[model samples]
Target: MSEQSTTDSIVSFVLENKLKTILYTWAAGITGSLAYEWSRPIPGSLKIIHSRVYAQAITLAALGSVAAVEMYQATHHPDKVKKVDKHGY
Candidate 1:
């Protein structure tokens, strides 16, 4: 088999780390929020269930639930995630 290239190795390393994956999306969300603040709303886009305030609330709730799940798994099934030395230097 051919050896993995440097780009492939870096992508695999990042994807294998779960916390880094989630935190990366959170970084993207910050950029998207900044864009939303500067952009005007589209015409005729408002709906009873799809307004900006409602959407933001739902997104926040989803993030909170995911965080809860991560905490629960880390506490009860640490082996399910990558093992790391918390205090190794």
Candidate 2:
């Protein structure tokens, strides 16, 4: 209804879709890594597989960090997740 509520709902919808969110993040990272590799003069000097592996590592690290933070919040401050930041918190 309200502008803030509409924005919040859209963000909530995106966050709720775990597979879509993860895939989007992974694809962004992988594409970025591959794009950089393709532009390098010595593309295969470091090995093409290394770029893929590094991209996967970065994706896993990001996902793992978010999961850890979410688990911590669920265990230590579960109520906060349900409450939106109303006063610019």
Candidate 3:
């Protein structure tokens, strides 16, 4: 209800949106590579298995890193986040 609390809430919303945009942009960059590999035909069962395993490992690693960094920032320096004003100008 206080002025500072309202400001903080607005800031948090903006920061969350910004982080989502960044993550989505990163995902878009990877989508083409993923689509190409996914469209390919694997010659053997072993190769298919290896590809799936590798993809899973890589996705997990990347997500884990992003989560870790987000957690660290949220816990240690949330105040560093920026909030955009409501005007669309």
Candidate 4:
């Protein structure tokens, strides 16, 4: 039996859990951006906490939109999804 390499395993995982991977990636990007912004010197009287909250809200909204689109596709075009499931893209 041939064993899959680490790269192959990681690729398979990402492909199989595409939505989850996307969410994680999106969240990571948001967090990184926020971290960078925070690292900069704070402007006098500016509220960083509000900005963080807004960023989180935006991320959640974007995630919800993606999930809704995915659901719509799965329901409206199930055959296409099935084909992908049977044969990896």
Candidate 5:
């Protein structure tokens, strides 16, 4: 297989796995949010660590809620799920 096809197949495999997608989403959201929060100055009473924890918790909660909703829709309303192309567009 060519390099492009290999890359595409790897991405396709990741997208096809719901658990992997959820874990990836959580990891990305948590790390991205933590980085953003850490870069900002700590507000009034909150410490830097507290702000980081808050960011991580909120990110995880939000992403978890979204994943739960998507899973629910997939299970109960399979027809409503959007289909993706081979490239995951």
Candidate 6:
């Protein structure tokens, strides 16, 4: 097979694995949020469970944002990189 077709096949494989893809996206957000919260100093008076819930909410929001970008990327190719770069820099 040609190089372009091989690359296309790999992308197709990832797109087809719906459940794994979703878990990965959400996991990324959860990990990122947890790390962010860990590095900051919070009041000790706050309940641990409440803090955990807040962290999870932050993670969910991040995951939603990522999912939206991925959905937009799927509908609009070639332009995806431009959109990411515009936001990144």
**lDDT winner, 3 or 5:** 5
Q: Write the per-residue lDDT of candidate 2 for residues 16-78, one digit (tens) a residue.
A: 564566677778877888778878777475746767787788778767755765566567656
Q: State which candidate, 1 or 5, has the greater TM-score.
A: 5
TM-score of each predicted structure versus truth:
0.39, 0.56, 0.41, 0.47, 0.43, 0.43
- Model 6: per-residue lDDT, tens digit, 6-76? 65554554545545655665566556656665666775434444456765675576557556655654776
Better of 4 and 6 by lDDT: 4
RMSD of each: 8.5, 8.3, 10.9, 8.3, 9.6, 9.8
Question: Model 5: per-residue lDDT, tens digit, 1-89?
Answer: 45656644544454456566656665776577667766777763455466567656765775675566666667865875679799955
Model 3 over residues 1-89: C-alpha lDDT tens digits? 45656645544554566456445545654564455556777655555565566565656665665566556657767787344478821
lDDT by residue for model 4 (3-85), tens: 98885566456546767866776667567756666767886234356456656776676567656655655776565444555
User: By descending lDDT, how would the candidates be arranged?
Assistant: 2, 4, 5, 3, 6, 1
Clashing pairs in 2: none
Winning candidate number (lDDT): 2
Worst 10 residues of 2 by lDDT: 7-16
Measured with C-alpha atoms, the lDDT of residue 66 in candidate 1 is 54
Cα lDDT of model 1 by residue, 37-87, tens digit: 446454434432234454465457546655666566567657765555977
Q: Rate the local accuracy (lDDT) of all candidates.
A: 0.54, 0.66, 0.57, 0.62, 0.62, 0.56
Off by over 4 Å in 6: 5-10, 43-89
lDDT at 75 for candidate 6?
Answer: 77
User: What TM value does model 6 have?
Assistant: 0.43
- How far residue 67's Cα lies from its native spot in candidate 3, in Å, is 1.1
- Residue clash pairs of candidate 5: none
